[model samples]
Target: MILTFFDQFAIPHLLGFPLIIPAMLIPLTFFPTTNRLAQNRLSTLISYTSKTITKQLMLPLSQKAHKWTNPLFSLMLMLTMLNLFGLLPYTFTPTTQLSINMALALPMWLMTVLTGLRTQTTTSLGHMLPEGTPTPLIPMLIVIETISLFIRPLALGVRLTANLTAGHLLIQLISTATLTLFPMSYTLTALLGTVLILLTLLEIAVAMIQAYVFVLLLSLYLQENI
Candidate 1:
């Protein structure tokens, strides 16, 4: 019975077709194409908002990293849309999956490492150990720093997955309680329902914040490499 709630997170398939691909693609439909001017109010707003976000994200980055603006902007938009859509009834969250989060994190992390290695080999290797280290502590510090460096992608994936999973589970549990109590007590049910509404609103903010954070961290990593 406990597994029922988690089953919602599993990728659905039918007759050998994976549904997750379609789900991921659904967000693309909402975006306006660059072929036309965004004359409509909604389209204009979307354009302005996207540009503002891109600018903010690129502010701390060096000139070399500015080339990543388009890719990073699209990633943030996709992540934001997927997270918001997941809040709707009967929808699934792709970011809630560790594999999906890791897929997103690993390549970006590797790119940063590779860029650093290619452009600034000495600086990149220098990060593994501090200068003027005591002789006895040099080996231990290198091991610790190396472990931390390798753990970056794992940390990224786990942070996103754990936050979304915890929020969704709370929502499900509270919603179940509200429904189960309705017949016995209208007053308590109404109160719980109110709390659920507030929690849902909070989750919406969380969804957006988490998406921003994911991209912001990537930008920081890029900054270090460049």
Candidate 2:
């Protein structure tokens, strides 16, 4: 099926609200703390679903949040799935849209900030502040930090949106230019189409790069605070 921003949310919402946001574990509900010990016991006792639910029901929300390690990884996977599958001719790339990127980035920014606060490293907030200066620098740093913090998500959202949107549009524009010059020039069309095909491959690589950038920065932010 063709991918669109609405399709991303609509399909999941139709199924279950829980599916909209990424889950830490895929088949296994909560992450196993000790490893295969619980998995081995659970497997021998009853069905996997039964085991998963029982394990999940027993845990508190705080505990569950602590176990979540790969949130940015999950977001990257979702975005990758949307872009790769939708790259087929007429399908839309939701990654190319600001709305979708904002949705992804906004939550990430909030999570980053909240994580910093919870981890009790408020001094790490000084990254947005200046290095060394006089008393007058305090006001300047406050304004600068405020701007910097807001820009984090905005920059993240726009970078991917603009790159993907521009790349795809460029390919389309090139093909359209050729068509205008020689409407029936099968040779020119074939050559340009090959270029577009190559670009599509490049776009797949870019998808991975985008994911790495997002996740790496996320990890870096956590490391700084922790």
Candidate 3:
């Protein structure tokens, strides 16, 4: 009954209710709540892991950067949860969309750039041209650097989109092939099923890694500004 191959990527509606409501909310269900006196091992593990990652990210930043830890940690947790949840069968991944990725990237990138412009105005502008630049190349260098600066958010979004899209496409292709080949060749179908399972596991790792990479790059961007 699927109308198109890309239906899996489509924003789904069920019973005239936007499935996106649950698609988005499911990630929140896994988050560790604050009101509990004692948490399960899974929650404790998530807390410890998040704290460890936050510390590593903030290590190179200044003492004043502590203010950013909360937001960055929260964003990382949200992204990680969204990604891991997407691996579930019949689920949609919002981070797979360029618009969502860009939406997440743009504001943080802008805030960092703005912070640089505000607190470290001279230093921020100076990032455009390096020291000991030949006078002849100064104009060209500034133009190149400026372009690179604006491209940061675009890069962030494209990276996340391309990676997730490629993985999902491959998964679809392999799964379809396995199903199609099942009747004619049991051996081939079984082989492909194994491959599909392996790919799914790999995709899970990729989902986590991509989320971390997104936040890690953002933190690096903040490092330049902070």
Using all chains and alpha carbons, the TM-scores for the candidates as numbered come to 0.94, 0.63, 0.92
Candidate 1: where is the Cα deviation over 4 Å?
34-37
Tens-digit lDDT track of model 3 for 1-226: 3445667777788888878668878888765467652657776876788788888878878887778998988887788778877778888888887888899999999999999999999999999999999999999999999999999999999998888888988888899999999999999999999999999999988888888888888888888887
Cα lDDT of candidate 2 equals 0.61
The sequence of per-residue lDDT tens digits that candidate 2 reaches over residues 1-226 is 2343234223234255643234212323333455564558665553565345334432333343434444644565566666564456544555666877888888877776887677766566666676785787888888887888778888888887777766666666665666665677879877887887788788777776675566555555555455
In angstroms, give how far residue 133 of model 2 lies from its true place: 2.7
Query: Which numbered prediction scores highest in TM-score against the true structure?
Result: 1
lDDT of the candidates, in the order given: 0.89, 0.61, 0.86
Pick out the ten consecutive residues of candidate 1 with the lowest summed lDDT: 30-39
Q: In model 3, which runs have C-alpha deviations exceeding 4 angstroms?
A: 1-3, 15-17, 37-40
- Which digits, one per residue and each the tens of the lDDT, describe model 1 over residues 1-226? 5898888789988799977887788878876676665467777787788888888999999899999888787788788888888898877789899999999999989998998999999999998989999999999999999999899989888988898898999999999999999999999999999999999999999999888888899889888888
Q: What does candidate 2 score on TM?
A: 0.63
lDDT pick, better of 1 and 2? 1
How many residue pairs of model 2 clash at the backbone? 0
C-alpha lDDT of candidate 1 relative to the true structure: 0.89
Q: How close is candidate 1 to the true structure, as a TM-score?
A: 0.94
